[model samples]
Target: MTKDQKDNLFLLVKSLTKSEKRQFKLYVGRLGVNQDSKFLSVFNVLDKMKVYSESLILKSTDVKKQQLANVKAHLYKQILISLKLNPSHQNIRSQIREQLDFASILYHKGLYKQSLKILDKAKELAIVNEEKNLAFEIVELEKIIEAQYITRSISNRADYLTVQAKELSELNVITSKLSNLSLQLYSIILKTGYVKNEEESKAVTKYFNDRLPKLELSKLGFREKLWLYKAHLWYSFLMQDFLNCYKYALKWVDLFYDNPKMINLNPVFFLKGNNYLLEALYFIKNKPKFINKLDEFYTVVNQSDFPKGENIEALVFLYGNFHKINQYFIDGSFEEGLLLIPQIETELIQFNNKIDAHHKMIFYYKFASLHFGAGNNQECINYLDKIISNKSLSMREDLLCFSRVLNLVAHYEAGLDYHLETLLRSTYKFLIKMNDLHEVQKEMIKFIRGLQDIYPQDIKKEFRKLLEVLKQYEDHPFERRAFLYLDIISWLESKIENKPVGQIVKNKYLEFYA
Candidate 1:
């Protein structure tokens, strides 16, 4: 059954590494009776399966069709218990929880002193590591134990516990609120991109201010400050404030470097912070700092102790290669960047399951831009067509909108514009439907639409005029977002000057004398 093949247990079995599979079997051997169990039979069959089929499973194992569901569920739980006991899966959080578990067992056994001692150690570890949520739980257990039997001196233990609980509870509430606000802002950005107009800007600003909890800067701990900075960073992104994005992103990355242990403990957040920092630098066009920060990111991620889980590896691949390609765009070295495509494409195929459609399309856009810059117009159109023909993609509409605009340019450059009128009408309608036909896009579409009537001899002059018109919007608040998608100005210059767009950009960025 398709549903059977897509079940969580099937996927879980597929995700296990060889050693993990071996460990699961050895764990079963620990309880010799379980080795002959129906769940174990189901697991062994599923492990050998290239694809899950209810019928095949029924035939392979002693588990009957009626009992398959129960067996599969039990097997799933057993595998998880085996994984939970794995030494490789152990981390500080797990260790703290392990202590808490032992404390609970001891407490249930009426060993009050042993339980209290364990709880105290776990509470300290949780607080030190900013695991205050768990620390609060430990305190609650301590309170329960204290109520049953007082363990300490005449000083009020209840008063100390009450104060600790109250403080941690307050801090957790703040962290939760900030993190929620940050996620909401990020979702808005992913949905509609940066603030499109004054209406959207006003709405986002009001929402941010309304929900952001007020706090004293110096009173916050490491976790609270980290989420606080993230809230501001996402807000800055939604507001299209590049300088503020850079400022908050820097503070975010710096927070981790200031507390080195948190880096490995929270590797995903650390990678995300560095990625945002690199993005801010790219948006600001600061090549020097971008290069330095990118190098530093690669150095840190490649370190021996960096986390090696599947999801983290996927992110590292995503952000690392994404920035590396952006570096070529920043340097205007499209031809050099082309060398990376084959290898990247190979890797993308390998990461197909882990990476999402949005990121894949993003790389396609980057590839399209590279070809466009190097004057490989037909090649550029090839990539753009892949994006355009995908009718089901629900990525940010701006990506789709810009893809259409760039497709128009690539088609014209490739001399395949016999159907230019039809293409123009469809693209114009698409943008208008998305309510995104802004000035930069409007001018480009208008100029391209007017191309049919322009005399061949006057085309160069027309290109110059369009360039002058677009230059005014280079610093225009919302209009500039258009240029971030595609450098129409450079393309126009390339046309007017009769040079490759890549060369036009290279001359401006590369330090040839040095």
Candidate 2:
């Protein structure tokens, strides 16, 4: 049997909605010979099975082992065709492509005039939709038709197409370069988290500046500016410049609002831009703007006119749950945050394939944090254990390191002494191996390691001592990234003041607001 993840046919079958499934069946039934076809049998068998099983499929369907691959391939293509025919899946891009297809057929059948007419209309629509790549292709097609037919005013038409093609080509090249730079930077951040020190920052800055295209911001169109903002946003994130990240992310999101058609056309980018903006606000502790923007995001995404599809639904779920959890953290309502875990877990299962391992681990880290703030130490440990045990995750080494540090703190808070020394030694070695043993983690491990020697009466003093030490690093450019993962200062204050972590955070938030 093919591995479940690699079995695209089975995955597609399982991903289909009830309505989509019905549409596929009806589509298949439209052809009289396909009503009870072998592929239909294969689809029904595969859909009913919880997992992709070759043996079960052979037994349940008429397809033999030798023919199974071809059958499955046919079914996959048919399903995609059916989905393309679905109204929800049709958009401006699809409409333009359909016109191009019609023009191509007309051109082949010696209908040059009709083909040119269709190509002209398609090019206008593509340009209006900012589909420059397609527009360029349409221009090329028009040039080909005009070359053969020798249409009237051929001199002006040749010059017009030439200029349009050259300009579009230049703009597309710039968009491609910016998008490539943005993706590379984003990939680097995902694989290694933010740049760790000044050297790394300089390297990233150099790379960003070298690849970023030179262009006047005022002359760029919506698509060009969107990619430009994304490039800068990723660069800012890698540099740990949350203020600039906020600035570019806001520009990215606002560009869509300024051109409202793009909000629906490129909803995923709109959603991600807002998510990053909220993240930057969270980092800067701009509670009021964070709340306001988050509200706006939800309001826009929930609208009846908003784009809805499996991909969009998955992003909506991921971003919505993420910010919902962040809201609790901002408000210091950890107990209320705990209520979201069940729903998040449920959706996580439903969208397991759609959500990547790195993001799932992030949710686990947040889950552990919420439990820790709510004073559920054991629950925090349980969630942290998920991150610690996952050996395959290569992204976000920082998250891995902090999960262990947070795990150690949770065990201490839960009053586990017998294994404290064991955890301390292992965590120390792990941090050393990762080369991430910074002062904040160093002081934390040191304080926890000395806990056994300190008298019960001295515990508060130790907490106060650690609190004072971490406070200085809270503002340190490099060391402050640690606090972004776990609010150890607030945690220590909770211990020293004999209060819940959530209460300490809430008071801090209130103080910031005041």
Local distance difference test scores for all models? 0.90, 0.91
Score residue 458 of candidate 1 by CA lDDT.
Answer: 97
What lDDT does model 1 reach? 0.90
Estimate, for each residue in 369-412, the C-alpha lDDT of model 1 and write its tens digit: 99998889898999988899998888688899999999999999
* Model 1 pairs whose backbones collide: none
Model 1 misplaced stretches (Cα beyond 4 Å): 2-6, 510-514
Candidate 2 Cα RMSD after full superposition onto the native fold (Å) = 1.7
Q: Model 2 segments beyond 4 Å from truth?
A: 2-6, 153-155
For TM-score, the strongest prediction is 2
Tens digits of per-residue lDDT for model 2 on 1-514? 6576558898899899999999999999997999889999999997897878888889998889999999999999999999999998999999999999999999999999889889989999999989999999999998898888877745699889999999999999989999999999999988778877778888988999999889998878889999999999998888788999999999999999999999988999999999999998888888789889989999999899999988998898888888889988886899999999998999899999788899999999999999998999999999999999999998888999999999998998898878999999999999999888889999999999998999999889988988889999997877888988899988888888888888999999888889
Clashing pairs in 2: none
CA displacement after TM-score superposition, residue 327 of candidate 2 (Å): 1.1
Cα deviation of 460, candidate 1, in Å: 1.5
